[model samples]
Target: MLAVLVSLLPLVRVLPGCHCQSTNATAAITATTVTSVVSGSLTSKVGGYAVFDCPVPLEYVTRRSRPLVIRWTKNGHTVFTLSGGSLTTDERYEGRTSIVEPPEFSDAIATSINVSSLRESDTGDYECFATHKNRDLQLTASSQRPPLPSSQPLSHQSSTASTLSAVGTDIVDAGVRIKLDVQGGDIMSIPPINQTRLEHESVHFSCVKEDLESTVQWYKDGVPLDDLPILNGRFNVSLEGSLDIYDAGLNDNGFYLCRIMSAKGTFSAGAFLNVQYKAKIVYSPAEVFLAFGKPGTLDCHFHSNPPLTKIRWEKDGFLFDTYNVPGVYHKLNGSLYFNRVGKEHSGKYTCTPFNDLGTEGPSTPMDLIVQHPPKLIVVPKVLYFRKLGDNITMPCEAENVDNKSPAIVWQKADGKSLFDPRVTVAGGNLTLTGVKSEDRGVYRCVASNIAATISAETELIVEESLFHQKNFGLHINSTKKNIVAYWKRPYSFCTVWSRDTSLKLSNWNATATSSDGKAILWNLNASKEYEIMVSCREEISGESLFSKSILIHPKVAESDQLSLQELNKSTGPVTDSFDIRVERSGGNYNVSWTFTDNSRKDQADVERYQVKWYDAFDGKELGTASTEANKRHIGR
Candidate 1:
C-alpha cells in the first residue's frame, strides 16, 4: 500500500535565535517504492522572457551515475529537454527556442534556464520538470504581455523609460530615436547694442550671433544686406558673433538683424546700427581790429563741446605771418594777437573752422580800429602864482575820442617829462604838484595810437597864478643882535621851500593858516635890519613870479641926537633944539632933539649947526657953542 501526504512549510530567513523543529517518520511496509515530486508555476508574455528552477527536495540519497533531466512542456506536452549540461531543441520549437545555459542535475544544486527574443505566440504557461532516478520536480511559468512602443516624438519631449512585464519580471524599456530640430529656436543678438558716443565722434555697429554653427545672413529693413563693403566671406561668421563694420556710415544707419540656420536651430536678432559722424562747428573765429603799433587785446570765444579748432591771426583779410601757422598749443579757443600792428596791420580777419562732419563753420568777421597817435589836451591851459616858494601843479588831458584810454606823456620845454619826481600820469592825464620857479615852462601832452595813425597834443603854461602864490611879504625884525624873520604864503596854495634851486621853496607848511592867500607873522624886532625876498605863486601849476626884496630897520627917537637950543625951545627957529637931561645911571647923558619948522626954513638958512659942549677932555666950549648957559648946562 502507498500513502501520499501534503504539508506546508514556512521559510525562516535566519531570524535571531529562533529554534527550528525537525520531524522524521519511519513506516514499515511490504516492498513498495515512493518518488518525491516538487512543482512551481512560471508565466511570460510576448517580447518577454523568464526562467524557472525546481526546488531541491528535503530528503535525498546518493546515487552513482544518476542523471537529472529537465523537461520543458507546453500545455502539458513535452516540447524540449535539457540534459548533460546541454539543451536540445524539439521539433515543435526547432528554430524558436534557445537556452543560454543548459540545465544539469547535481546533488544539492538548483539550475537556471534562459529564454531569449520571445514573441506574442510564445506567451503562455510553461512547465519545467527535473527527472532523476525515482524523483521528478515540475515548475510552471506564465508570460504576461510585452510593453507597447511609445508614439510621441522624443525630439519634442524628454526621453522616458516605461515599466514592462515579461514572464513576471519588470524591465526598463525605451522606444524610438530622438534628434534636435535644426530650425526650432534660432536667435541673433543685436550688434552695437551699446551706444557710447561723444559729440563730433564716429562709431560702428555689427551683427552678432551666439550660435555659430548656422549659415548667417544679414538683413536690414527685411531686405538682404549683402556685399556690403564691411561684410565679406572672411567676416561671414565670427565667434565674437558676426560681421562688424570698420566704421559706421550714415547710409548704413538702420536696424539690422542676422538670420542663421543650423542643425541645432534657427536664430535671428535685431542689431542696432549706428553711423557716427563728426560734429561741425557752426561758427568760425571772429575778426578783431586794433590800432597799429599800439597795445591792444582781442577776445574771441567759441561755444562748442570740443572748444575751438585753431586760433588763427589775420591782417587785412590776409593771414598774419606771426600767427599764420598753427602753434603747439594753438588748438582750442580763439586767438588774440597784435600784428606788427603798424599802420598797415589794421584790417578785417575771417575765422574758419571745420567740423568732423566736414562742414565749414560760419565765418566771424572782426573789424579793427587802430589809432596810432594819441590825442592830448589840457584842463586849464594858463596858470599863475606870486611867490618863489609856492606849491603848484600842471595837469594835461587827452581826447576821449576812440573810446580808448591812451597813455599821456607830459613833455616839458626841455624835452624832460616834468621833473620826474614831481610829475604823475594817470587816465590820460599828467599832473605836476608843488610847482616851483623852475617848473615855469611849456608843458605839452601827446596821446598817440600808431596803429590808427592819430595823435593829439595840448600845451600848458604853468604861470604863477595871482591867488596861488600870495607870499604877501616877509616881515623881519631884530632886537639887539638877534633877528627874527617869518614869511607869509598865499592861501590859494601851500608854500614849500625846496633845497633845489629849481624849487623855489623846500619846506612847505601846507597847514599854515592864511587870511586870503597871505601868511602872517607877529613879534618882529625893530633893531637889526633884514634882507628878505619873496615871490607870488599859483597852486595847481606850481608857478612862481614877481619877487621883491626889502631891508628893515628900527625907528629912532628925536632924543637920539641932542642940542641945548632944542632943549630950550626958545632958540630962534629951534634950529637944532635938543632935549638933554642928566642922569646918574651909568653916568651917561640922555638927550632929545628935533629941527623946528624944518621945511619952512630957506635952503641957505638951513645951516649946518655944530653941537658943542664942554668936552670932558677940553672942558671948554668950542667955537660952535650957542651960549655960555648951554655950556654950563652941558658941564653940569
Candidate 2:
C-alpha cells in the first residue's frame, strides 16, 4: 500500500499535465519555432513592410531540382518570391513598394524592398524561406520590427524658458527668474510684435502653459491692470488665463504679457501691437438722398469696445439722437428704429459710439441731401359737369414720403377747409367728400412729417347751372334806315356774355375786363334782333359763374336824301328828272324817280337816277350811286 500510495502521488501530479498535452497533441506538433531573425538591422520610420538584407544567396547549396525557391512574407502573408536568382514582387507592392536590387546581385548578395510611409500595422514578423522542389529546405531568416526615428527638435529648443517678473512688463528675456524680493511678481503675454488690428475691434491673448490649471496674471505695459481705474467696460480678463480687448485701439495697443503664478516659476509670452484705424462712414449717402421737404434716414456704424455705451447721432453739428443700433452703432443684437423723417434730417450726420474709455472707435460721418417737395397729382382734372345741388369728390395725390405720419391736409381757395373731419390723408393722398361749388376754386394740399412740410396747389374748375343766370333782357325799336346798334352793358363789372345756339358758345366773352380795361366785343348788326349773353363769376371761385342771353333791336332813321339831275344843251328839248324819296323799311329807306319829255310823254318818261342816304344811328352816310328808276334806285 505504501508503494502504491507513493506512486499514486507522482502519478497524480504528472497525470494532469500529460493528459492535457495528449488531448492537444496535434496543435503542439504543428506549432512553429519561429524565433525572430533580424536583417538590415538599421531601422527607418518609413516603409510599408519590414525589410531584410540577406547575407547569403539561397541557391548556394549544391542541390539542384528546383535550384532555390525563396518565399518572402510579412505577418504570415506572402509578399514576394525568389526563384534561383530571379525575384517576383507581389501586385500590391508593384509601384508603391520596390526592391532596391535584383535577386542575383553579387554586391551584398541581397537587397530589401522599400515600402511607402510605415504604419503601425506594418509591425509584425517577416519571414524568408528557401525551398527545393517546392519543399522547404531551410528557413532563411525573419526580420524583427525596426525602431522608429525620433522627431526633429524645435527650432528654439536650446533657448531656456522665457520669464517676466513684472505683471505688465513686455520684451522679456529668456531664462529669467521671478523673485518677489522687490515687489509684485506677475507676468503677461506680450502683444505680437508690430501687430496691427482694426480700430474698435477685439484683440485676445492667452497665457499658455503645460499646467493649464495654474493662475495667470495679465498686464499691459508695466502697470498692474487690476489696479487701474481706466478699466472701464473696454477691457476684460478670462478665467482660462486669457485676456480680451473688446475694442482695441492705438492707445490700448502696447506691450502685454501673461505670467502664471505657478508653484515652480513664472513663464510668459511677449508680443507687440500696432493698432490701425480705418476710415469709416456712419451713413449711406446714396440711399439717403431726399427731396426738398422730404425725409431721409442715414446709417451710422462704428467700432466700439465693450460695445458702445451710447451712440449719439448728429446732423450738421446739431444734436440728433442717441440710438441703439443693430450691426450699426452696435452689434447685430442691438436695436434702433426711426420715426417720421423730414428734410431737416438732410445733411451730414455724425455717429459716435463711446463709453468711459475715452472713445476708442471711429466716428463716422455721412452726407444727406434734401430734394424738391412732392408734386400734387389729380385724376380726371376736369370732371363731368355737376348740377347745382349735386355732390362730387376730388382726390389730391402726393407721394415719395420718407415718413408716413401726420398725413396730408386739404384746403380750398375759398378759405374754407375741404372735407373737414370727414377727410382722410393716407399714404400721401388727400380725399375730399361732399365737394360743393364753393370748393371749385384752387385747392391746396400740404404734406408734413417730422423732418419737413410741403404744399401743392391746383385749380378745380366748376361749371354753373344753365338756368341759373342772374339777368335777362330784350330791346325792340322802329327804324327808317338800317340801324347799327349794340347793348350797352350795365355797371355790373363782373359779368360775361354769349351768342350761340349751344350754351357752350365759342363766341362767349367775359365782358368784365382784366386789370387792363378793354371792350370785350366790338362789331354789331342792326335791324335784326342781336342776341347778347352775359355771365356772372362766383366771388370765391373764378370757375363758378352764371350766364345770361339777351336780344337788342334798335331803331334807326334816314336823316338826309340827295337827288341827281342832268341836262344836255345840244339835245334841246331833252329833260332828265330824278326824285328823292325817304321811307322806312325795317329801319332803312329807299328813293326812286321818273323823267318825262316832249318826245314821249306817253311812255311814262323812263330814266336813270343817282341817290344817297345817311344813317341816324351814328350820324354817318354811305356813298352815292346811280341806278335805273325801275330798280327803285334803292340806297342808304
> Residues 1-636, candidate 2, lDDT per residue (tens digit)?
000000000000000001111110111111121111122111211111222332122344323443655566765678767665556876645433434343242322223333432222333445555555656542222112111122211111112211101111111111111111101113322211224476767876544344556777767776677865555677777665667777775567676655566765664443444566532334343334444432234555554433445655666787664443222232332223234344445567666655545454435456665555444454324223344454545555556554443346766556775546556665545554554555455566676554456666555434454444444332223243432223334333433343443334443433223111112222222323445544334444444334344555544323322211123322222213222233335434444433433444433433544455554444357666656643343433
TM-score for each candidate, following the candidate numbering? 0.23, 0.23
- Give the whole-model CA lDDT for all candidates, comma-separated: 0.39, 0.41
Residue 611, model 1: lDDT of 48
TM-score of 2: 0.23
Give the per-residue lDDT digits (tens) of candidate 1, residues 530-582.
33334444445444443344455554344533443354444444322232333
Lowest summed lDDT across 10 adjacent residues in model 2 is found at: 7-16
Going through the candidates in order, what is the number of backbone clashes in each?
Answer: 85, 35
What lDDT score is found at residue 150 in candidate 2?
A: 20
Off by over 4 Å in 1: 1-289, 307-336, 355-360, 379-636
**Once model 1 is optimally superposed onto the true structure by TM-score, how far is the C-alpha of residue 42 displaced, in angstroms?**
67
Give the number of colliding residue pairs in candidate 1. Answer: 85
